[model samples]
Target: MTSYRWTMHRVYDATGNDTLGPAAISMWWLARAAAEETLQGSPLASAWLKLFRSHLSVDDPYWFRWAEDLAQSAELRRAYSGLYGRFVARALLSAHLGINRFVSLKRNGVVIPGSVAVTRISKGDIPDWIAWDDRASRHVLCEAKGSLTSRDFLAPGVPKCVKEGKAQFDRVETTGASGKLYPARWVAATRWVTDHRGGTPATLLWDPPQDHRPFSEDEAARHREAMTRAWLDSIAPGLGWRDADELLAPDRSRMAIVVNAEPGPVPPSQDWPELPDNDLPLIARLTEVARLDRFVAQRRPVPSDGPQDVADLAGAQSGSQTYQASWLPRPRGPEAKPHQGDYIAALATPFGLRPMRTRADFDLLRRAQDRARDLEEPAMIIGLPVGMDPGAAPAQTTWLDGAGISRKQDLAVFDLRRVKVDLLDSGPTG
Candidate 1:
């Protein structure tokens, strides 16, 4: 756009070499340095960067600095004018700023936390590069792709978000040069490429009209202007300082339902003197009485043959009072077993669980669960419910509640054929 005393031809004419056109090579090297410099934090540092003498090797002398002038010469500019501007923008952006982030643009206090590139430009993919950044909040999703111009933005699989975009490059770190990093922003693409990552149809860049008609040029300018506005709005929220946690509050609230799976403990009878209006208690009492009556009738003691025999029979069931209720009938069918529900097992820690049972006891029991061999340890009592069918074997259960106080749920029948093990005696109670 501006005249310069040192032109492309002057640089290329100084050397007689050809191939790897000087302009193309210059732009390539400039782009690489620009990208690295931007990453290091200063976009303008490239202005002072000098090419190494070795760069004049057979790789093509016409490619660097000199070739750049040829590509932009009045003779060539009319034929490839669009490419000239795009190439300049790409070099400037790469030199001073990174992709996917607007820091290249010199906006203050903006950072894309997890951005990473997954593709490159040379694969005929058009987007010189692509990057991804996740949404900090459910309401906001941000990602960006950049190219030399709108035409270079499209790739067969590229998505719509980056089809054609503009970028303001900023300083970033790099491993090259003297390792001196500073803040420098650079001007880059005005067109975007796509939104999607992975798979085909990822992005499409707008193409400049081949005819270069006046109307097409005007339309292209208008579209480019609209895209800039959209880019500003898309990245505006990220630039402002706001609490991401506040935006995430609703997600936290919805999780409370997971804890409500179990009803809380029945409060102390004294604290709740008046019973709940529900008739559940009445039904429970009647059920218990009927069960006790049936058990007594079915388990009539045989007439004793003598005092010695009676004493031996009594010994058949040996245990302290704490384990009296551990022997209960198990359920019928193949499914008969003790199931430790999540809430039921978790209750032992808060309430004083049982006599001689300290917090240490619960910890030991939990560890034992992991090792199959440790399951039969003496501290836990194993028994089956009284009514459990003989065909349906009862489960070996460990009592967590304080020493078998005959709670209603505790006596629920597992099956009829269980060998009751008394917790106190550490022996069978039949």
Candidate 2:
């Protein structure tokens, strides 16, 4: 560490999110990777991304049943290693980078198609972000913490990630401006967690060992040098400190810094914000952080526009475009239109789902779930066929696949925007 100048910049997120700390920072990285799309004509722009999904997930019930029993008595480990990382990482990365993704680190750098973040530092490591820039042929290392020039610190639970900042200054050396002055350095623990927006950014001139008087520049230099060595030796001995600068520059691949990366899709939304999201990555990530009950309770995808279930078939359209499906038990007559109020409604767009004849629609004879969220106590008169046997065994469901014909679900839940209201079938199939 020679005579160096530290540069820090303050930027606001597009969503006005303040807590851009660890989990927020980390998850945003994942979200961007999840969102990026490969160009069609630009061969170089096409980078393959492989989405890795862990078997151990937050959505699984079996794990929590015996999570406490997961012994670490011997050469063993906690059951939630991957899960903790997933939750923290996902939470951190997206913590700050909301819909706009406004925090651009470098204006010009190589855009690695499937670039990877290397050596994930702990909650407070100086270099948490170490990723390669395939385009610039370099590796950018970033040590990010919120600005600490605050007159007051955070209240307990005011900013959740602030508790994790305790480790940032521990075992780290400090310096003062002169031998005559007391040594001082900005400590994350004492400062308020840098969330959303706050005081203007100010440069801190670190000082040496404590005293009442100020020291000369020469004294500050000596303190900085001695403390720098101690800082490196104690905190980041393995950081390859010597070649850090080289890796941070373009054409620095000559330095040995290798990160394993996998191939994945380049979504159209990556290029066009207005485009629809594939959300495969988000679905995979939430598997780690989602509550088990959420899956069972909703029993469906929450993001209305996300990937549709195979059983869902053709999902709802932006407009009220008519759709057709090879429905089960077949329609008895021609059109079965009930009162408008009889339909299971949605908040955004009214979901139109019905014509379910049996359990064969979703596998089981009795689970033909036609129950409404609120069935008006009795049931809305939805024009049931005459002589209908509610106790009759459900018909076997057969999934019919086609782009030529659109498919609609037999039922609709809360997400109206994503619902595929199965309406009247084509005529003359008696």
Candidate 3:
């Protein structure tokens, strides 16, 4: 396995007082973003994935030579750096701030027709992406910039990018369903010092304080619905779906399968064990039983119909629409069972069986499902492998001020690593 690391520096206000924080990036998420966000259904998706993997610090020597060859060309280096920068920025924002749903302003009308309201403002100098913060009930505007220059040269250019990003943020405005303008948070994320051999990869986040604005419940609902649809649009083509409409078809149900595996060779289909019987029913009805608030919190696509039985799959008549399928990879080694693989599947209607490793995995899915059904809130299930002590929470960093008194903030620094991937290789089948 090849491990990659980076530091996240959060700048406070325009003065740029940097505080280090803990952030993580998943290789699976990056691959998905490369296909859906960067290429956006272009024919170059596979080629881009191959190039991206080569840029990483892989175990293979050939990939290192390939990266060196690409870096020799200034134009290719810049293009690779810029595209990868946006990918890292998106992953960081999602992991640190829970800003998962992103809409590209450049494809505003095509992706989500008439969703954003930018009438009075000119289209020039707009931010790259507009995302909704479900936790804070507000909108966020971000401009992403990347550079492959040395640290000394990159430092001087960051402030210039920040100034330009802030200008772009000022030009866009969006109102919610209540006809009230949602509070906006502006961020300029720049990926500087990208060469790992010379220095660690880092992202300088410039977030400036803005005027306080009120947000209404109606507006939150509107944004969540629109953004959920937008998220589907972004992921559908990459998953081999015809379009977002097919996943969101009112007559059919949808399922999102999250598979957790150790970092190594891809496991075979027969290695997938059967799911526990007790947990099967809840997994089938996750979306149908989902509370409005919980659904809004997750912002995933929903199905219009009610729950059905998994047994019906056996005798179902031909030409009947049943369920849709897609999967996500969460490659991590469980402490207890290091070699085993697990699955967490979410469905809008009843679906057939699949394999999961342990009872704890089922319990985690149950809690998440119950939260959607009863608590009306989203669950955080992206911690380390289950059935093992997670240890103490990450320690908060502290520093002394000029007055000699110490001040502390919630910040945890950590590393992110993953195994290499071959995009052309076939994944496990049913």
Top-scoring candidate (lDDT):
3
Which tens-of-lDDT digit does each residue in 1-430 have in candidate 2?
0001111111111122111110101122332222211100111111111111222122221111111212235222222322222222222222211111111122221121222212222333432222211111222232223322343222112232232333432322222222111112111211211213232111111111122233355443343333222222221112222322321333322221111111112232221122025533433343322222111112345445443222111121111011111111111121122211112111110121222232232222012223322331111111111221212211222111110001121111111111122322221111
| Candidate with more favorable, higher TM-score: 2 or 3 | 3
Per-candidate TM-score against the hidden true structure: 0.15, 0.21, 0.53
Supply candidate 1's per-residue lDDT for 368: 38
The parts of candidate 1 lying over 4 Å away from their true place are 1-89, 92-221, 234-238, 241-430
Ranking of all candidate structures by their TM-score, best first:
3, 2, 1
Please tell me which predicted candidate would have the highest TM-score against the true structure. Answer: 3
Per-prediction CA RMSD (Å): 38.9, 27.0, 21.5
Residue-pair clash count for candidate 3 = 2
Model 1: per-residue Cα lDDT at residue 365: 36
Report the CA-based lDDT of candidate 2 relative to the real structure.
0.21
Better of 2 and 3 by lDDT: 3
